[model samples]
Target chain A: MESTYLFLTTVTIQSSMAVLFATLGEIVTEKSGILNLGVEGMMLMGAMSSFAASLYFKNPWLGVTCGLITGAFFALIHAFFTIGLKANQVICGLSLTIFGMGLSSFLGRFLIGKTGTRFLIWHVPILNKIPLVGPILFNQTPLVYLSYIFVPLIWVLLYKTNIGLSLRAVGENPTAADVTGISVVRYRYLATIFGGMMAGLGGSYLSLFYTPGWKENMTAGQGWIAIAMVIFSTWNPFRAVIGSLMFGGINALQYYFQASGITIIPNYILMMLPYIFTLVVLFLINQTEGAKRKLGAPASLGVAFEREL
Target chain B: MIEIKVKQRIAYPKITKFFTPFFALFFALLFGAGLFKWVGVDPLKAYKIMLSGAFGNFYNFSEVIVRGIPLILSGLSVGLAAKMMLWNIGCEGQIVMGGVGATAIALFASPYLPNYLVIPAMIFSGFIAGALWIFIPAIFKAKWNVSEIISTLMLNYIAIIWMEHLYFGPWRDPEGRGFPGSAIFPDAAWFPRYLGTRIHLGIFIVFIVTILIYILLNFTKLGYEIKVIGESELAARYANIKVTRNIFIVLMISGGIAGLAGVGEVAGVYHRLQQGLSSGYGYAGIIVAWLGRLNPWGILSVGIIFAGFMVGGDALQLNLQLPSSLSLVLEGALLFLVLAGEILPKYKISISWKKLSKS
Candidate 1:
């Protein structure tokens, strides 16, 4: 029973890491007031590029870099169109997703069913020796550890820094930020690129650590779940941990049910829990006025910023 | 150093709007050439092959029409919703449920119904199923002002999962050699087709719906209210337009249209509910809707051309040994380029290079 308990806790953390990274990334992006709906596509591209690059270079770290670069590249396209060209953010973001998905599928065809360099489980010496908490947290891929650091790091970056203040100001009121000498365009571009890198890192975690291979649509709506998590957490990085864990818990539950020979609930229904939960979360957030006020979306979210000339 | 400046246009030309898509296509082709070259395929040859493959013969053209049927419907679905600035991203799920609805009737109730009633009943059920699928998100958006985009998108995942469950579990054909789908739909459920080609009655359905939607959006009171709401909800409210009710109505119609696309696949083309029914038609519809600029006529034309791209893409897979997702890449690129081009009419942009003077 202790073993099962340990297994579930570890699996929950392991499964949630990808989404956790993406949620934190999107939190930053959305905080800059740009609603990028292309996380799924960026993640796919990142996964495919990282897997292929790692396979070629035979180095997991290089693959990780490739993933991050590819994600940033895709996000750059979105930024160019939505931020630079002043196009509709939603349409540009959706196009990025479609383009990313298609490009990844086109490029990654050769990588199908092929294994590459992957991050193996590394246990920290002193940390792994602790009680039940130690093994579950300490024994994970480097990406998982990165996710753990990112949650607090992003929280600090968003809440405790002047840069975060500028970023939030840009998202909330770009005109006001522009008046204050903050470059709305630069802040938005950086925030978007950083978000993309995080999403890419999340995708890398899946290809390198979790599933350990490249597949079409491999992220399997986790990117979208991450987007929903950004909302579920009310755009706060710390609360994003709860949202990601909840998704991870759902995934672990599905895994456990299948492994335990449980037939009471159908497999597809179990698969649907995350998406259904997202809708429920959105509904709850919408219905609760207090939650809405405290954790409302940035005023400029999804609206392209254009300074009056 | 280079300095760039942008100024809003005082008078945007109608002619520019007409030509923007063409220019965007030209740019996308130029960009696609680079992608093709990188992938080691000759761009000219690829383009030639695609053009010929799509418009090669009468049969091929008919196939393009067949592919366009769902695209046009789903495009119309998305376009109608976009008229009110609502993103019905869940059209994919709505399409699946439409197939499920049609399949349920085809498998269970066809034997009890008259031949004439089967098709209409299937159509109605399919439409209702799609509407019902989106109704939850619509109500939420109307009542509590939820983001329809995310909610609809989430429902899309649920709808597809539900459809898979139906085919793989409860509705699996008993004597079908353990295949993961329902039994073949009855003849009564099958839609009428042209004599030699795979083209079915869906083309006519798409045509009528397009015209009807055009008329509705341009001529009706509800259409005027939708346009007003799309412009500004605050203005809409002040003008006494029931914004909430209109949103619900528009989404219901949008989902119903997308559902019709699913019905076409099962009843008109496949004659059975099966895997690969959704196959990105709903997502493709978004590109079509946007490329068409949410106009019914534009959607019809763009939907056909995009369908040709898909047919041509199949050719690439066959002869060039390229992944069929090439069409998706082109579609995405085209949409992106067009989205960028959208700024042209609104603003005049200028770039100049400058030399730094020595101090």
Candidate 2:
């Protein structure tokens, strides 16, 4: 029973890491005046690229790096349309999603029926033995710990730093930012690309570490879930961590319960638990005063910024 | 010798709008050829194969038109919503609910209704289903000022899951040998064929709807109000256009049209609800609507062009040993290029010739 509990907790922690990385990445992107509807596609590309690389290189880190680059490449396309040319952010994002879906599907067809080397955590002598917390915290892959570190890093970067201030300024009013000697376009492009890289890394975590395998549409709708988590968290990176964990926990619990064969709830309904939770969270957030303050969202989010119209 | 002089100030043309798409298409094809080369396929041969497959046979041509019908309908849905500055991304969900509504009527109400009555009932059911699906987001936006983008998108997943549930469980056809799909509709419910081909009356319906929507957008009071609202909500409010009411009405209309596309898919083509009922037509409609600049007539033309891409992609898949995704890549590239191309006409680029020569 102790071994089983440890195994379950380990799975939960790893899955939660995936959610954490994706949600936090999306939070940054949305806060930069760019709503990336293509998160799903970017995630899929990352998953496939990372998986393919890991198979070829026999190293998970290489795979993860490749995933990040793949994500940035696609984000470049998004930036070109949305920031460079001032196209509709939503449409460009959607096009990126469709394009990514097609590209990933095509690539995945070739990668199908192939397997990659699985990633495993090296036990840290004393670190792996400190009871419940040890296995959950220390005896995990480097990416898992990095995801935990990212929450605070993102918080500081978004709220406490000079670069963050300028990023926020661009998001709030690009014209004003430009007037103030800030390159609004440059900041937006950077923020969007950074967001894409994080999303890619999150996808790599799924393929390279979490499930440690390749499958078509493996990211499924996790990209969209990350998007929802951004809203549910009200755009706070810290809160985003909690929201993602809750989602990850709910998702993990459903699978656990189904595996245990409790025979209480139907599996299909359990599958829908996360989405239902998202809707409830959306309602609660909308009802809250914090939502009115708009503390977390970029003011110019989703609006096209034209320099001289 | 002919000489072309570079002007110091870029002279932007307002009437070159027509040429922009052509330029964009040319560049898109050029990019597509480069991609083909990357994949180790001969671009010229692949292009020939794709074109012939899309337009070669009579049956294939009919299929393109048949596919274009739903695309046109969905494109009109998006175009109409855009005119009001309402982004209806839930057209996919609306289309699904529309299919469900039409299916519910065909399966349950067709037994007691006359053949003439069935078609109208199905169409109405579809419109109602689509409208109902979008009503929640519309209400949220109108009342609470919530972002419809997020709400409508979230609702899309719900509709998709709901659709999967119906097909896989309660609505599963008993005669389908365990396939997760609904029963095929009765012959009385099937749409009439056009010109002895597999193409149905749905194409004609799309054409009629396009013309009607063009009239509604160009000549009607509601269209004027929508235009005002799109231009400036403050101005529309000052003019007493009932912004909230119009928002609700326009969203419902957009949803209804999208639903009609679903109805066309089920009643006109499939005759039975299946798992993959829509091949992203609703999502693709967003691109079509934008590409057409939200004009109803333009929606029709772009819709057909998009359908051709879909058909050509399938051809590439079958004949050229290429993945169907190549078409998607080409389509996306086309959208990006077209958007960029359109921008050039609005804003001219001026280059410093002396600096260029120095470089």
Candidate 3:
């Protein structure tokens, strides 16, 4: 029983961290007034390329870099079309997902089953002594620890800086921001690319640490769940941590139930839990006034920006 | 000084509208050729084999239409709802539910009903099932201002999982050595096949639906209302167009059509609601709907092209010793190029480079 408890906690943290990274990335992008719906594809790019790079270079660091570059590369397609060509943001985002998914699956064929260097657990000396939390929190892959640092760092970057203020201004009112000499387009591009980078890093954790191997369509709807997580977390980086943990807990619990054979309900019903939970949470959030105001989307969230002289 | 500018063309060249899609197709083929070359295959030869594989023999050509029938119906589902600016991404869920509904009839009522009665009953049941699935998102959008994109997509997971439950659990065929699928659909419930070929009457059903949708969008008042709503919801409301009702109406139609695709697959293609019943047709239909510019005639043609992508993927796998995922690559690249090319007629782009003079 004690071992089972420890195992569940570890699974929850590891699973949630993958979601936390992508959710945090999307929060940054959406906060900058660009709603990129290509997170899933970008995650796939990260998961595949990172595995490929880790294997090819025989270095995990190179794998991390590959994931970041590939993710940003896919996000670049959405940025170029939606920002550069002034295309419909939804269509552009959807196409990126398709293109990214197709390309990743095509390229990832050989990488499947071939093993790469995976992130190993590093137990901190003093922290390892903690009773219940040590095994789950202290002993984790390096990326997991970095995620803890990165989450709050991103939160501070988003809420406590001049750049953050400027980013918010652009999202709230791009034309007004333009009047004040803020380059809305440039900030959007940066925010989007950074978001993509974070999403890539998140996916790297999945391939490099979470599963430790490449597979076709491995990211497997986690990116989309991350999008919903942004909304659920009220588009705040800090709240995203809680949201990701909640979802990760559910995912972990489902596995526990399946493996333990404790529940009378079928495993498929357990599989349906996260999705049903999303719909219910979305409904409940919609019903509340404070939540509605807090979770409201940016005014120009999906509108194509056109600079008319 | 060198400058680049894009201008909206004033003239609506009627002939150009037809040719524009062809231009997009050409661009996609060119991009595909580059991809093929990168893969160490001759682009021209690959495309030749693709074309011939899709249309070379009677067998190949018929297979193309067989795949296209469901695409056309699902495309119409997306196109019609998109006309009202109601994004029904839940067509995947709706399609699955439609299959579930059709299969219920086939499994339960096939023993008693005559073939004619069973077929119509299954199709109608499928449409109703699809409609029921979409109604949730529509209501949420119309009343609570929820984003249909998220809700619909999430619903797809639930629908698929629920179907899997039936396949693996209660509905599992006992006679098939514990296979995770239902018994073969009775002969009475099966769609009539043609000329010793795999093609079913679903081809005719799709053709008729396409014609009807075309006339509805071009000549009907409801279609005008949908167009107005799509362009600007405020304008549609100002004209007293019952925006909320229309949102539900269009979604219902969209869901129903997608559901019809489900029916076609279960009855016409598989004859049993089992694993691999869809093969992602619902999602693929979205690409077709957009590529077709949400028009019936355009959908019919685009559906055929996408069908070629699938048929050709099979050929690539069998002949070229390559992965069948080439279809996905081709589809994704084709969509990107086509959407980019669409910008041409709307805005004429001009670029020039010259030496800069010091200020």
Interface RMSD of 2: 2.1
Alpha carbon lDDT of residue B223, candidate 3? 83
**lDDT (C-alpha) at residue B36 in model 1:** 92
What stretches of model 1 exceed 4 Å from their correct place?
A289-291, B1-5, B349-359
Q: What is the lDDT of residue B72 in candidate 1?
A: 94
Q: For model 2, how does the per-residue alpha-carbon lDDT over B143-201 read when each residue is reduced to its tens digit?
A: 66666766776777778888888888888899999987899998877888877777887
User: Which rank order by DockQ, best down to worst?
Assistant: 1, 3, 2
The Cα RMSD across the true interface for model 1 is 1.1
How much is the lDDT of residue B319 in candidate 2?
A: 85
Model 1 chain B: lowest-lDDT 10 consecutive positions: B173-182
Per-residue lDDT of candidate 3, residues A258-278 (tens digit):
888888777888898888877
lDDT of 2: 0.82
**Fnat of every candidate, listed in order:** 0.82, 0.37, 0.47
Q: Provide the RMSD of all predictions against the true structure, rounded to 1 decimal.
A: 1.6, 3.4, 2.0
DockQ of 1: 0.80
lDDT of 1 by residue, B1-359 (tens): 98898888888989998888889999999988998999899999999988888999898899899999999999999999998999999999999999999999999999999999999999999999999999999999898888898888988889888887888888988877877778999899999999688898888889989999999999999989989998899999999999999999999999999988999999998888888998999999999999888999999999999999999999888889888988898899899889878787788879989898889
- DockQ, per-model, please? 0.80, 0.50, 0.61
Runs of candidate 2 with Cα error greater than 4 angstroms are A1-12, A122-125, A289-291, A304-309, B1-11, B353-359
- Displacement of the residue A161 alpha carbon in candidate 3, Å: 1.2
Better of 1 and 2 by lDDT: 1
